[model samples]
Target: MKTKFKIIIGLLFFSLTTFAQKDQVKILKKIYAKEIITDADLVDYKKNATKYGDVAIEEEDKVYSEFYKSILPILEINALGANVTTMQKANFINMETISDLSSGLNGTLDFEKKTGKKLYTDKINETIRNFKPIFWEYVVVLDGQKKYKEVSQAAYLIYQLDKKDLERLYIAAEYALRAKEYDKSIQYYNELNALKYTGESTTYIAKSKVNDEYNAFSSLAERDIAVKIGTHTDPKIEKTPSRTGSIYKNIVESYIAKNDIPGAKKAIVDARLTNPDDTSLILTEANLYLKTEDFDTYKKLITEVLAKNPNDADLFFNLGVISSKSKDGQAEAEKNYLKAIQIDPKYRNAYINLAVLKLEGETKLLDQMNKLGTSPADSKKYDVLKAKREGLYKSALPYLEKAEELFTGDADIKSTLLNVYNALDMTEKAKALKAKK
Candidate 1:
């Protein structure tokens, strides 16, 4: 009998204990909510409010959620710590009344653009009309006369709730970011930061499980820092080099980094104007056009230059190149190359260019070889003449190789020939020739 009685008592105690336990925040809310609330609990709330100011807030479907979660709790906790006023009370009532009224707002929202359906056509909007005012039970009336929750409701409600809850602030910040209200998000993040919430600064902080570096830059802070640094001039990097091309390149780089393609092109043009002798700049502009796949512009630049200096080796070389790439005029290409070589007697590029042209016309090279002769003595004279035909290489080896071929029998020419042969990867032939010598 004694054992059974003890068990029953124990069960009763356990049940009571289980039922007695409550969420601290909810408990505080109920306690402060009542008049003549315990002074001990009020004192506790004071300490907590001082230690942790406003709590984190998030989006709430109900209108009273922010008021209940943020404004009410913060205001109430602060009021309990100090003085509560009628005006302050009125403000709280007004807020809560507005909240309930807004909460009751139920309507479908639709949007229309002049052009009809668009991406944001189905967006939601809140609307309510009418309000009513009451003492403790806050409410606001809109337009034609209806009452709803007012500020006093929020204030008094906050006064009753615990001020330390923080989970909502993160939600608030996230929603702010979604709404493109970065500045407001930053404010919330900053509030969290002030409380020493490490993860408040980072977008991924919400998923933080353990030890991680605290990110201090909220989206707003990040933007602000960019603005701050952006507004301030860095005289060092900004200093234009004495070389006109260098300055021009730097300007182009800056404009490009800012995603101003036109600005970058303009800088190149300006630089060309500043240093008309800098052929590289002109080439740069043409290359820039080519890079942007603006082949028309590229042609314009080179063509304009060619009009002024038809004999320009670089221009002719590029024109011939574009022509060949386009497969438009091989015959004209050969002619221009020949002219470039004629204009510049020692033009090595002209020779290389003409040699490339011969890749498609291998048989044409025989005609060039015929110009040399069938015999060794004739070969010598022929090779020398071949060397003079840099531009004529519609299919032929250029001057240097031709020169080397002519000197093939002479000791100096033989040595030069051997080196040239080695350079051309005919090492075995070069070795055989050396051995024969």
Candidate 2:
């Protein structure tokens, strides 16, 4: 008889517990169905539902997750507009709209974590998957707009979602550099270096039937599919060169921009060890030495570079530029500039610079001429200096004219040529240049 009474009590407890669980599910369903559900509301519901034990909490979480999943589309439509394109065709969206949608999705993710259920897993995953490429498209548009900070943000989003694509991280770093966010750029670049991302790949391309233009596909499979379809033809594969050298080069440049000379020196040393064959890296080192006023080392490095790349006219011209910085470097500057002109006969800037270098010699003569008195000896000296000045102008005239001939569109060349002509008393040429202006 006592055992029978104990069985009766257990049955009563089971019935009451079942009733409470059902009651919790019912109440939470009403709460989740409200016109506006907040985080606090969800928290309160979860707390109340947990009082009825695991079964009640599971039912509430399942219901609440489903409710969130259903409302997500509405939130997206509202944030993105009713006419928003499909995921594949996502275009420029302002940050406000993106933030709104991101907030909703993040909240859903949070909800899933708190609930410990797999109720809406697939849908949320699909949405996140779509977000990566959409953010890439946004990055492209933002970069064109020179909204570099936004580009960094969008690229970082892509990186977070798909860390395997180091290109996205690289894009983030580059844009961060452009945005002058040095620390962020350094951090991203460090991550890339640690990952040893070489940025080498094969690109599959096909000619589009619609525009007769070549379009690159994301993958070989996609390219093959496009080729199998009638919309594309003449598929080809192109190998993209590794950007390893440039990555290190930019890191050094960022360090230099931050005025951290020692850091720059260390970075350049490390970078050269990684990519010694990259002449651009050598040029960067030469530039760093130039910045630190280590002229001997700068010239030595540049000369070394010129030996390896003898046919590079720009290197010769750059050497000329470096030499031109000192009062004693005229002959060296003139020699380098002449060598540059010889290599590229139509090198317009070299001609202009050589002319400027020649014209620079007149400064001392003019200074002496300006300090002269009206005495006969001073007058004689003045005449000699004046004649020398005319001779200098005469010598510079050919280069100025050649520069103007090579490129008729450069304002600096035109301005310099006009001044030279005026100084040399070449009235007809001066008037003609003025008329053109």
Alpha-carbon shift of residue 415 in model 1 (angstroms): 16
lDDT of 1 by residue, 1-437 (tens): 99999999999976654443223344544543554545665666454433222332222212222223332333343354446554565554545443432332221111124334342223212011111222323322221132212222332232222124344343344444444444454455445445544332224111112333233234545545544564322111112223345434544554554566887788787777767866556667777777677767887888777766677876776766666665567776777677777777655556556655654443455476676658988887666655544233323434435534444455654554454465456668777877763
Error of 2 at 27 (Å): 11
TM-score of each: 0.28, 0.74
Among these predicted structures, which one has the highest TM-score?
2
As a TM-score, model 2 comes out at: 0.74
The global Cα lDDT (0 to 1) of model 1 is 0.48
lDDT by candidate, in order shown: 0.48, 0.78
Q: Over the stretch 81-157, how does candidate 2's per-residue lDDT look in tens digits?
A: 34567552443345544554455455556676787766555665666675556656767778889999998877776
